[model samples]
Target: MKEESQTIRTKLAKIRFFSPEGFFVCAAIITVIFVAMEALGLRSSVAVLAGASPGAGAPATLGMACLYLLGYLAFVVLAPIFVMGSIFLLLVNLITGIFRRQQRHF
Candidate 1:
């Protein structure tokens, strides 16, 4: 029984939400790219989010531009949100690992 409990505790410590972490990291990277495009004067491409440029008053030609910009902003925000969520999960996993390790030590 002791050996079996030890094995279980060690196994639990290695477990993690690896898939979600990978996805969030990827999304964050993509967001950074979109932000870069917006920075480099690619407004039209970034305006696809809100579908309109109500605040900027960029004119009809820039409508699409504004929409794309909004899109980029949305993605940028979402990426961080996802990354944060992943980080939270990581913390939870770490906590559980620690608990299991402590339990096994006895």
Candidate 2:
């Protein structure tokens, strides 16, 4: 039992996700996305919907622009929520598996 506990601890340590290297890689990805958005001049759509630019409709409001921005933000927010939810589900499954296996041993 002691050996099994040590093995699990070692496996957790080796996952590397908690390391500084992994953190910086994720930060770099986020930075790149922001830079690309600025370069592409795509931020105007979000600004208009958020009412940063009310005169953006002076020529004629497309209405589609705000819809696109809403969709984009919804997708961006939902992606991480979905990913985290899946990770939580995976951890729950792992814990349940361990408990079931231990019960079988008894």
Candidate 3:
């Protein structure tokens, strides 16, 4: 029972997202997505009024445009910001952990 408990604890301790490196890797992935979206020129596809509307398929176009806009915003802005915040949180956790360990040692 004690060995099982120790193994469980060790597995939990090794979880990747608990560390700063994991957050940095996630941020890099989000940055790549943002760049890809910008390069694809899909960002401006959401401008509904900038071009003449289709005579019969306006609704379909509008729906697709909204979807594209949502995806663009998600990958271009929200995902990167969320990843950056995660990285910041990871850094804070690391710094506090270091300080707490030093305090315990002293």
Candidate 4:
């Protein structure tokens, strides 16, 4: 059990997510979606959340509102996390590689 805990899990660490490339992709996708929704005037549709409608199909308005809200949340939350994670992972990998290379020469 002790040895198992001490052993590094290289497979999990090798996952492509949260890498510099992945983060940039994630942030770009999220920003695109948020901008698209904003450009479509979806923010006004979110008034459905307050039980107010533009006197049209209530279901459609509600759906658009929910989508906008979700996109907004993702933009506000996940985008920053991905950006920070990518930067941190890149720096850590760079520093570690430098250290390992020096140690190998020594």
Candidate of highest lDDT: 4
Residue 46 of model 1, lDDT score: 34
Write model 1 residue lDDT over 65-100, tens digit each, in one string: 755656676686767777877778778879999999
As a whole number from 0 to 100, the lDDT of residue 15 in candidate 3 is: 54
> What overall lDDT goes with each candidate model?
0.66, 0.58, 0.67, 0.83
TM-score of 4: 0.78
- What stretches of model 1 exceed 4 Å from their correct place? 1-20, 44-70
Per-residue lDDT tens digits for candidate 2, residues 1-106, read: 9999999878655645433433433444545565565566655655565567765654333354554455455446644554555566567768999999999999
Which candidate comes out best when scored by TM-score? 4
| CA lDDT, candidate 3, residue 24 | 54
Alpha carbon lDDT of residue 80, candidate 1?
72
Arrange candidates, best lDDT first. Answer: 4, 3, 1, 2
Of 2 and 4, the candidate ranking higher by TM-score: 4
TM-score of each: 0.51, 0.44, 0.54, 0.78
Every model's Cα RMSD, please?
11.8, 11.7, 8.0, 9.4
Q: Against the hidden true structure, what lDDT does model 4 obtain?
A: 0.83
